[model samples]
Target chain A: MEESATQPPTAATPSATAAKLAMRHVDFHYGPFRALKDISLDIHDRAITAIIGPSGCGKSTLLRTFNRMNELIPRTRVTGDVLLDGTGIYGPDVDVAVLRKRIGMVFQRPNPFPASIYDNVAIGPRRHGRKEPDVQEIVERSLCRAALWDEVKDGLKGPALALSAGQQQLLCIARALAVEPEAILMDEPCSSLDPAATLEVEELMLELAQEYAIVIVTHNMQQAARVSSMSACMMMDPDRAGVLAEYDATSLIFTNPKDKRTEDYISGRIG
Target chain B: MRMSPRLSQNLARAVIWASAVLVIGLLLFILAFILAKGLPTLSWDFLTQNPSDMGRGGGILSTIASTLFVTLVAVVVATPFGVGTAFYLTEYTREGRMTRFIRFGAESLAAIPSIVYGLFGFIFFVITLKMGWSVLSGGLTLAVMILPTIIRTSEEAIRTVPKMYRDVGFSLGATKWQTIATTVVPSALPGIVTGIILAIGRCVAETAAVILTAGSALQLPTSLFSPARTMAVHFYIMAREGISMERAYGTAALLILLILVINVAVNLLVNRFVAKGR
Candidate 1:
């Protein structure tokens, strides 16, 4: 059931550029089993889009699809059109490495490089071939963006592994920002984090959404409600494999939805 | 419930203490055994003179020099190869049948006897290439034989380097090679160094391959192609064919001292590195 309107969305939002990422009947497979089934949606530009679902559902897999990070895993294949900035990102010309740079990713657990804070942030910009960067400015701006400068400014040279779990996760966010990526794909960024750390990351995500498009996969429905501007729910069909059963704006998905599965999921009846 | 988990864990306290003592005792016994037979024979004459024909009377100065030159060259040769091979396997390559085959080959090579390596050296360097039993041939052979040891240990070191470092570099837009050079290689330095030092020890202690490849000669090595004899080879020759038993004993003492000093230095460096890593 499409949200048919008398007015065309393309004509109305042409100048505004409503979608940062759009998928057209995208399908994903791990060997023979399909993880995402003929799914399609527009990830709103410069807004936090959260995907919520039960374990083993395709929520995390879908977020990974944005940057093509799933290509890193063996036996994983994706089909159909996955577009970024109106360009099909999965086309033959798209370099996965280059694509990854434009759309930075952060994983569930904090994974800071075994290096100094300055080096960690400088890694992305420097790798993409910028030599002798104004490392000081970029590091400061990125960490400040992630709200970690006050905690680690004086100890930039210290090993990043020395930080607590929360600080390390923020460091990862800062690392993602260093490349000046257009979007950030987060795969359960707060799942391994404590509530306090979770709040810190959620707030940071909200703040970051003002600059970069954010698509986060979180199992927490409350987290989906708290941070996301739009929410997508996925479920494994009874006779089928992994699939996106429902997708909608956060307000529409949580309070009132046309799909029975989406309502059951939001109310914790089928979870 | 009555006892703390810590206390219960200490249930094997006696066994652990006894095992520790036994280990220390065994190590000491070996050291003492080597020293007891080797020390008194060490003398200025033993250090300065040449080996007496028929295995005994002369000094090992030339042999000592040859050992140093050969090891220095072999290590220099092995370092790049070992590190490169390790980098390829650990950082660049993905796991598959070919990678698995290469890994298995390296493991098997590491386990193969030094004598087998010596035979391979003799066949390849001397007989096939016709390099004719020289210091260069010996050094090259040793380096090749030690390749597996170097590769295996270096791979372990490189593997231990957290994957995050590579990711950090890649995310920064560092090319595949760039990430390995800047982040992966540097982070694994201590391990690579440890592997190199251990390889150096193997080179120093090795007599089989060098003896088989480089003809055993007492003369100072003047050129890369000239036959040279290492200390271990010299000692082996003395023990088997020397003129005087006293000279052989003296040569033994000197060789033991050299091996002991090098091992101690490596141990100290490795310990310091482990402390830093911690």
Candidate 2:
């Protein structure tokens, strides 16, 4: 596949911009089973960094560690440092709720609450104690940011579940954006969508990357090549734990990967 | 030789249809018999006047009052505890020895007979606690008898809510309690209310437990401390003593109507909630 000419050249180098998130010597385990082995990486601000790997290779697990979403799973443990804007997120003083407000997430399937379209977007800001007037503004602005406001503005009182699957996914994005997070993590956001919806989401991701730090874990390598500025490839070790195999600009990862395993996986020879 | 698939399918269908018809036909026959015998006895005065002459000559307003009061107490006292325990089991605590133990206890409690519960209530609430045979004792006993039903049903209802909703709530920066209160509980409300309605039905239909703990007084109960006779207990006494078979059937018919009305009203309320949620 050819690299798009519109790809940002500055992201080809790791040191060109300050990192928004920095992880060092991180390892994760679920009970006695190690899921992620020693990993270190830097994710720059205002860029879409894609993590691509085969199933069970811990790509989603790595994405989850950014906002401590992994803590929701029982018996899961993480060791080492995960820093956001140079402050350790795992520190004793950090409030997880406040931490999550600064870093939002969108899941694979569209899970709009069984509530009105307006209430779904308004829920986050309302949860953080934002009053009605400000919440109204946030709802409209967030929906606009998600590119869903135009279709839904007239029927904000309608049930969110009544929307098409693609629209529901976008509504989830608006709901996540309502709290105004600095970074967004998406886990296979297009896996459940039709090709048309996938294209729309891809366009939205490109637009969102200009403002928020975005990390996406996808099995679709072509999708990574199409949208991401930087890309990281993961592979399972002989012991079945996921390890970082390669990290580079999306163009380099697709065209000139330094690791032989990365080359084979990219060319569909091995996973 | 093995039966043909078509023949086997036909046999299964016939048996299922017959079973359903038998159940419905039996229920209708019983209801028709009671309504035929008791409809002539019912009137505004019968519903509103106090019974006299050992329930041979007067209406059943006092017994109705007693039934309502006892049911109100049972439902009011048990609802919070039942629903709260359900939330605790499903959301707050992880699945472990403690949750299993609590579930086991509730299941065992459900297995005990109502008459056995009456004996326990007679001994504990009536004799030991000195609450005496009154509305308080009877209601509290019914509350205990129905707790397991509410907890089991409510827990199952809460579990049916999609886990994705909780994940979304947490990802939106909601605290644990906030997530449960807003997303989880609202989704589970209809099922929980259904369980509470079932408990109310059980309370209204109880005879032995009420007779033992509430006593068989025919007067209109003045307070929670007043000994009273529920409609079921009164029906039992009237028919057993041969005081008035007609009046007993009247009470039975009214009890059935009252339960049917409650079921219909709650169904309407639940449908409204479901429609709003959608």
Candidate 3:
């Protein structure tokens, strides 16, 4: 683990870009059980970073920490610095609502509100007190950005739950985009989707990475290899705490991993 | 000899079918008997005119008015408190000693007899508060009586809403209050409304509580302060005093019909909400 931590940068990759979100020696616990330990990484702006590991590796937990979402779980404690644009987010005076608005999230399941399509996208802007006219524009622009505008333009008033699973996932993406966040964190956003829908989501993620910093946690190693520029491989330590085994440019992590665990996991030999 | 599985399965099915049939048959028999005896007594005049000669010679318009007023008061007063308590239990607090204590209190309240509630109301709202035997007194009493029903039903309804909806709301940057107001409450509206309607049914059917809290006055109540008699209390008085069994049956039949209409309306509302959700 120590050797992998000090491995030199392989080439001029997206890692050279300025960090959009930086974590330093972060540890998280649920009651007495440690979930993440001594994790440090820099997620770059205008790029897709993927965290991949087997189940129970705390990949999803790590993704949720980016926006302070783990605090929603009771008895959960987080220590160390998590900085957005180089400023710590865990200060006592921070308004969590405002912080969350700046860093949106998408879940594993496409949970559209039991409301009209237009309302689902408009929820964020409305909550933030945007005027109706501006909200209308934001909803349309967000749907367009998520690549769902063409499919749902004629039925904005229809129930969001009536959409197909794939379309619903896209609607969730549109909902996150409507908040106009600087970054988006997704927790296995495509695990419940079919292959066609998965492909569409991957394409949208690539486009979204051009504008906002995106972090995705997935069990699908191919998805990580296909879309992300940078990848982090996580594995559970003996004491059942999640530790980052490897982090590098996606190409190197898949082809020439510095850690044997990363290579073994990627080669389907171990998880 | 041991019973065969097939025989036991058939016996169980037979017992379940018999129980369902017995229940439905009893209900239909009672409904048919009341409609047969009371339908002849119901006329346009019987519905529109105020009772004359102590409820033997005219309509029950005054009793209808009193029932409506009392139910309106009870529902309007109890809905906020009931729904708010439910939200506090399900959303604001985690399961702990405080929540358990509150839940125990609500459950205990629900189990007490309606007559006991009436006695409490007589002591508190009527004599102590000096509200008198008026619509206000009876309505407030019934409000206390049905509050537990509303809380329990509303709590169950709110709990049934997928936890994922709350997660989505928070992820979109909504404050706690905003998330509940916009997402949680709306999703639970149909069930909440159903609970309130059930409470209304209880208020409409209450005789002991109404008679004790609101005096049986034949005259049309002109204000919340004026003493009034609900249909159930009027029916009780007519039958107990042998004033008119026909009129009593008429009031009972009308009450049943009103409850039926309310239940049907709730079904329609729930169906519409379900369809819209899809």
Instruction: State the lDDT of candidate 3 residue by residue for A101-120, as single tens digits.
Output: 99999999999988899999
Docking class of 1: acceptable
lDDT of 2 by residue, A1-271 (tens): 3322233435444432767787788899999999999888888788989999778999999999998889999999999899899899999999999999999999999999898999999999999999999999999999999999999999999999999999999999999999999999999999999989999999999999888889999988889999998888999999999988888788888999888888999999986
TM-score of each: 0.87, 0.96, 0.95
Q: What lDDT would each prediction earn against the true structure?
A: 0.80, 0.91, 0.91
C-alpha displacement of A152 in model 1, angstroms?
1.3
Q: Please give me the total number of clashing residue pairs in predicted model 1.
A: 17
RMSD of each: 4.2, 2.9, 2.1
Across residues B118-193, which tens digit of lDDT does each residue of candidate 3 receive?
8998999989999999999999999999999999999999999998888888888889999999899888988899
Per-residue accuracy of model 2 over B32-117 as CA lDDT, tens digit each: 99988888889999999989999997899999999999999999999999999999999989999999999999999999989888
CA displacement after TM-score superposition, residue B102 of candidate 2 (Å): 1.0
Candidate 3 colliding pairs: none
